[model samples]
Target: MRIARLDTPAGPRHAVALGDRWHVIASPFAAPLVYTGDSIPADEAVLLASVDPRVVVGIGHNQPGHPLPMQAWHKSVHSVAGSGDDIYAVRDVGTVNIEGELAVVIGTSATNLTLENAFEAVLGYTVANDVTNVDQCPIDQRNFQGKSGKNYTPLGPWIETELADPENVATEVVINGAVVANSGSFNLPSSVAATLVYVTKWLTLEPGDVVLTGAPGTDLPVQPGDTVDITLAGIGTLSNTIA
Candidate 1:
């Protein structure tokens, strides 16, 4: 099932996708989603971020040539935005880049989890656009810019409840309607489940927490007029304008 948060005439609501329509639900963060019986045409309802994670944990070093082991960091919740939102770059920064990644949403609170059972805490997966602002010229190691600002992290379209093979999911990064990066979750050295286990060992991940699985490769920089679309199989596309 594809679960989403939507803007409706009645107000914002949690919904489930069926066919081309979305059925309203009670709670998106809750397991065994309860339907509210109200329905909306898929195109009519405004799509919001798939999950309003209280905290977004970004993992680095999943890509190659990183000197350190895999690392995780906390991003301001204010950085979260829906697919249609604009990602504003810090003024005078003169640098903004994008990373199209697979985001793992936590369904249940978990801590000290082992690899054998970490997947259970995962609610589902969604597309994440890890937008960043390069500090300045002469950028080198230790300059991770996850703190770029609001609109940095765009997540949504919806969440897919089940993924049979996390590693095999295909991902594409599209800039201005062109496919610039083609990759897969398998590019990461470790499996998604293993990454979850590794993260949980250090911090308690609450329900609605998000874990970015890292980008497939070094992506091109985006400008104000450009639209970046991050697409993941099973999960829908997350599109955002750079403004």
Candidate 2:
């Protein structure tokens, strides 16, 4: 099922997609998927980030030929932004790169999980734009400053809870109406389950936490007034503009 969070006047609300409408539902992490019998037209609903992640984890430099299969980093929770929001450039860094990627949302707390059960902790999958400023510092430093900035990560449109074959999903990045990078899960060096296992060995991910699976292809830089669209097939597109 496709799930989304809406920005209602009352506050943020969880919703489920049914036909062409978004039916309000209870929190997916709290109780069963029960509809609240309230809904809005899918095209009319205002969206928020698919989940309110407390911790945003990133798997960087996981593309083929990287010495380390998994290079992890942390993005501040404040970096999270929803689709249709404007992302401003950090004043300290002149160059900002956009990395379109598939993000995993944690449904349950996970620690030292094995590959067999890694997916059990996953709530769903969503699209992510892992914004970065490589100029902030050397990548070897695991530059928290480089990766973590306000409104840096743009996630959503919605989450896909019923992904059958994640490895076969396609990911694309479009900048200013041009397709710059085209990739897919099949190009990933490690499976999502394996990345989870590797990460859980060191850190425990709690509910509502997010894991960015890593970006593919070369980094694409953006300036103010540039529009970016990242799409993960079977999920949906996440569009944002640089301000």
Best by TM-score: 2
Q: TM-score each candidate.
A: 0.91, 0.93
Worst 10 residues of 2 by lDDT: 60-69
Q: How many clashing residue pairs, candidate 2?
A: 0
The residue-level lDDT of candidate 2 at 9 comes to 78
lDDT of each: 0.82, 0.86
Give the C-alpha miss distance for residue 50 in model 2, angstroms.
0.9
**Taking the tens digit of each residue's C-alpha lDDT, what string does model 1 give over 182-239?**
9988887777877888788899999889998877683568878998888888787999
Error of 2 at 240 (Å): 0.4
TM-score of 1: 0.91
Candidate 2 global lDDT: 0.86
